[model samples]
Target chain A: MKILITIQENNVAPRFDLTSEVLIADCRDRQIIGIPRTILMTRPSSEELCGLIIKENISRVVCGGIEESHLQYLVWKKIEVLDAIIGPYLESLEKAKEGTLKTGTILPGAKKIRSMK
Target chain B: MKPVSFATCNNFPVTEILNGVPHGVAILDRDLHVMEMNRFLEVLTGFANADARGVHADFILRSNIGNNEKLFRNVIETEEYLSISGDIISRHHKKIPVHFTVSPLKNESGDPAGLLVFIEDISALQCFDKKRHNMACLDKILGHSPKMQEMFELLPVLAHTDATVLITGETGTGKDMIAEAIHNASKRSRYPFIKVNCGALPESLLESELFGHVRGAFTGAVKDKPGLFRMAQDGTIFLTEIGDLPLTLQVKLLSVLDDMEFFPVGGGKKVRVNVRIIAATHRSLRVLVKKGEFREDLFYRLNVLRLHLPVLREREGDIRLLLDFFMREFSTGLHKSIKGYTPKALNILTAYAYPGNVRELRNIVEYAVNICQGAKIQKEGLPRYLFIPVEEKPPTSADERRDEYSEKAMPALDLPAEIGEKTVSGSWQDVEKEMIVEALKQTGGNRSRSAKILGWGRTTLWRKLNRHGLA
Candidate 1:
């Protein structure tokens, strides 16, 4: 499966339309197959991002908040969207590799702060 | 009298105080991570305090603060207040215009502890600015003619009330835009604005589309679907081409309008809804009713507030205004810096009667802008159909216009002796320049009233004046 995650620096971008970087990972059987490639976009545009996703033939997309229109368009194109997931992109990628990432998962506070508390 | 210190006021509920400020407030730690945020900020960003704590400020705000963290970090280092206006992506992924005030937070030792951020939503102010001036535009709709000016004055009055609006106009006369302007200015602006074309879908499908369907309602109905009325909720529903609405569905729509309730396709339960109806059509509903094809009661009900959009040609002096407007619009969109139209091209455009109205004019400008290579759009840049002699084209209902301002139409002008001699043999450009020079001379160099006399936009007249060296 080819998983694409919208990122801002090290974390998942808060909004898909405003993301300028994306991490594309190729995994198999819920495990990593190779080193993930990072793609940098010239601008943050939902239309261009949609075009890039289709051009790259991404199988699944993991990101934070996304508008309903773009989400539906991606889903209609047969690509799975795991949206509204917050925290670092690496952790999101790990979850995706393990096939455990779910939509609307807020990770940082849940795993780090809640555990300490 | 006692002066309270921060230590003395430590018992006060800081979170509650921050929430009561009426503006979004967030406290960030040294690394620009979210340490705490008030209820207003939480609601705006869609991140509860529990989940948002310890998250990076950029992720929490999702604003145009900076592409990276260096600019924000600099704000703390410089220890100066930074205020900027930009858009913030809300939790729903909607862009919200806002103003931000970022200030450094200091500790008891006067060392920087974190940052204090204040956000003020300004979308309402932006909306107000667009509708502020009593000029030739309302939102996106543009016109300068007396008839359009009358309609503009009446639009705001009609938008304030809940009366069903019936917009009648020729196709492409911006009836949909008028309908939208009403919805945008109305009290229900916050709700969805739904549109449905009565003639686009078959009667059976359209019925289900307008008034949803229950599970197993038909062969394709594996799941229940809430229709457009339900989707619109407390908003406005625009029914275009209302004349084509099936008579059976017309009765259902009338009942819905009367009682604010309707039954979904194959559903026994009645669905109650509150929605404003705005219907439009090019065809006359009265004619349809006379032919027994439309319900008279429904037609009258929809006609509570009628707004008729005049055809493009009927709106005197609007042709040149719209031409310049669309020319600049397409030029900017296509990344071209188009100066203006050539004299011959301008004459052909201003002379041609646009049967398709504003929409066709917009398409023509877009095509010309795309094909144009030089600073000015030439005759070849326009659609070839525009170059067809007026007599050769098929006559339209308004084709009686041939007698009014056919290709032979020319404003009576006292031509200069030299120009009068060339009237029979000179190029159209020479005659056009002479006509402009004479008009300016007749108006005593007053471009505003000169444009009116020539039935052209002020910008168009000014460009022609400059071209003729009469400015």
Candidate 2:
């Protein structure tokens, strides 16, 4: 399975629409298999990201906050998404690899999680 | 005393001071790591200060500037203030317009310490701008024809009054839009503008639907329900296809229009309302009255403020305008980069008679935008039905052949002698083209007057002009 996570520096982007960087990783048996590949965007656009997700055949996505319409579209496309996470990107990636990541998850030492829904 | 250390400076109540500010504020160290942020900033970005501390500023506040890092670096090195305005994606992933200023912060010893950022939400301003633009584009009827111009001028006057309006037009001639425009332009615009299609429901159900029903009014009535007429109090109630109303309901409608009071189904008490009535129908009320189907008294009541809407084929020069409008609308909505229609496609669209009128034109443009792959919509993008040539029917019986021969035997009616002189030795198509050209020249290129002189609709003239390559 291929997983895609929107990132900013070493942390999850605060908002999905503002993300300009993404990490794509290959996972098997609930474990990451290789070094994650990083893709940099020239500009931020939800439509462009949607197109990329379809083109890359990403099965799962991990990100911070995401809009309702984009989430609905991703759900309709049958792609699993864990969003509204506030934490370091590596910690979120590890949680996803372990199949323990969930929506609205705040990492250790982080402040209280605020629901966006 | 020695200069205050950076650790000592961090011990200050930075969060408290920053929180007191109206707008969002953030403090970042030289390494670009977020050291402190205000409560407003935390709520705006959906990131708690505890989680945001030590995180890169780039991760928390995504800037639209292409080289945001370089801009921050320049601000840190030069110690100069920079202000910029752009959009930021919030916790809900909604873009919020914002204005932010970045300035250098100094320590107690007067040495540069860190960068201070101030952000103000400008989403309300952006919303107001968008509303103004939409009001300009969507709140008016679009037409340049003389008949439509007259209606446009009269709409405001009619909207100012509370009289009942009767709008007559063919299907898809924009009667609904006209009614809505009148409502929007009226004093009751802030109130509800309810619409009910009279023809879509049966007589039995329509009564209960228009007028509220009391509990146990019928087999299925369990509770008292307010109707559309009540819902449109002090507003407007647009009754579409009013000609389809049955005789029994017609009497009830007449009473309501006369006294502005009606009793609910199975209710003894009468309910009064102050709703403006706007009735529209494609059928002729006079013919229905002649057939003993429509109430004559009700007809006269509705006929007090009559508005006759012209068919699409009669409204010259508006097809292209509507086409361009719908094309741009659909292209933006579908995220396509469709520039325009190809020459051949445009010619075909211009020549085809829109039996469904503007609504059909909008639907066709939407479909074309979806299927069009190139920058311009081509002939292949059009619906298959548009490309199919209409087959001509052959004469079936002896009477038809004789009638056809007689029709061809007679000289063209009302043809100018000059056109006859020029097309005497030409084929039928040539003669037809010459006659059209003569009519156009006589009318000084006024298509509407030329069409009237040629005894044809405006769209027919447009089609012929394209066919003869004279347009």
Candidate 3:
């Protein structure tokens, strides 16, 4: 399975539409197989990211607050989307691989990090 | 009424007073932590009083306000009331435009204690403002013709209703824009407005394009794809040149229109969609139906709400209005401050017949703007083609003269008498074929001229030619 997570400053980007960086990882048996690939976009666009998700054959997506339309589109594409998460990127990826990450999950020490601020 | 003193209301609970107010009110400490909040604030932020009691104001508001610390410090230092408008993301990720006001709150010893924050949702007001602006722009975009004015009045009513609309007009008459305007003004404005040109694609690809295909549906089908209909779910799909749709696909389209459900090409599952269909065609579907090229049943299904856009030549009164509109639009875009058109230039433009409609007019304006060096666009700024006079050459050969003569005589002659005199002993089909061949020959194989001579649309003439095996 492949998982894609929109990221910013080593954390999940607060707004999905504004995210310019992404982390794509390969996983098997609920574990990361190798180092995640980082994609740096020239410009942030939700449409472009959605295309990337489909072309990359990403089975799961983890991101912070995403618009309703985008979320519905991903769901229709048969991809598991855990959105509205406020957390560190590494911890969210680990949780996603463990099948424990859920929508709106605020990870431990997230408040102290204050990434968006 | 006399102004009440604060000391008179000192015994009343500040929280009670704040709760009675309509707007969302939150009192933040000097550290920017929530000290107290009204009922409206609790509901607006989706956080209860007890839960938000000690939380940071930023966490509860979740606004895009960047310099929060500086804003709070400035308000405290300045001790002046401040109001600003911005967007705030709600707990459900719904972005809401809000106006916020921060006022300094003082302690008993006259020292700054905290800040009183007022929040008002202005999303509705913002939407109204945007709608008013779009309506004003739409008026200018649609033109000031009487036909267009009628459309403007009917457009809103048509948009409010969820029904299939069939728009008929000549090419370049803004059929696509009408479809878009309807979609933009409809309830599904928030959703995607998908457009597909029915004539642009081939039969094989068009099926899969409108009704998606599963992976391995064909040789090149690498992955499953959702079609335009699915993408336009809960919105609108503007199918331009719908008359060009193949007969085989017309059956499937009819089924989808009737049931609001369709099976993708090579996909077993039925995809139920709630999409409004707005089909446009430059060709006459009624003529196509009479010629048996278009299905009559499908025509009836799509023509539930018909809108026929008038040709530009018919609405000559709007030429000047459209000219000025396009001038201003292109001038501002090109960063050129063109004053206006010269009298000669304007007269030439107004007199010319615009076969390409408003689109051609816009292109002309754009071209003129690009070439014009002076404040006003002169005849010199016009396209070179506009100045090239069409030369009417006389017939050079006996055959050409005879053909030209027949071309002029056909429209005046009685059709049955002409066909009867040409065909002595033959079926009606043979007589019809002879008449078509004669018209085609007289017009020098010009389909449009032959159609006009035969009192038929161009497509109807083409169908007749195909029937006679001449095309």
Worst 10 residues of 1 chain B by lDDT: B1-10
Residue B302 deviation, candidate 3, in Å?
2.6
Tens-place lDDT per residue, model 2, B1-471, is 123244343576656778889888988776566788899988787778887776667656755644556777679789899899976666666666789899987776777777888988888888777644433423546788888888888888888899999999766778998998888778787799999999999998999999989999999899998989999999999999998998999999999999999998989999999999999987888988998989999999899899999866688888787888889999999898889998757766776666566777788898999888779987557765553333345533323433533353321222234422443334657656866887888889999988876667999999999999999
Kindly report, for each predicted structure in the order presented, the TM-score of its chain A compared with the true chain A.
0.90, 0.91, 0.95
Candidate scoring better on DockQ of 1 and 3 = 1
Model 1 TM-score on chain A: 0.90
The 10 consecutive residues of candidate 2 chain B with the worst lDDT sum are B410-419
Ranking by lDDT: 1, 3, 2
TM-score of 2: 0.47
Per-residue alpha-carbon lDDT of model 1 for B98-216, expressed as tens digits? 89998987776788777889989888998777656322236578778999999989998988999899999877899888888888878887799999999999999999999999999
True contacts kept of each: 0.27, 0.27, 0.12
DockQ-derived CAPRI band for the predicted complex in model 3: incorrect
lDDT of 2 by residue, A1-117 (tens): 888999876677766777799999999998898899999988888789888998999998998768879988999999999987767778888889888998877676233222111
**lDDT score for residue A85 of model 2:** 72
lDDT of 1 at B391: 34
Best by DockQ: 1
**Winning candidate number (TM-score):** 3
Instruction: Return the DockQ of model 3.
Output: 0.13
Clashing residue pairs for model 3: none
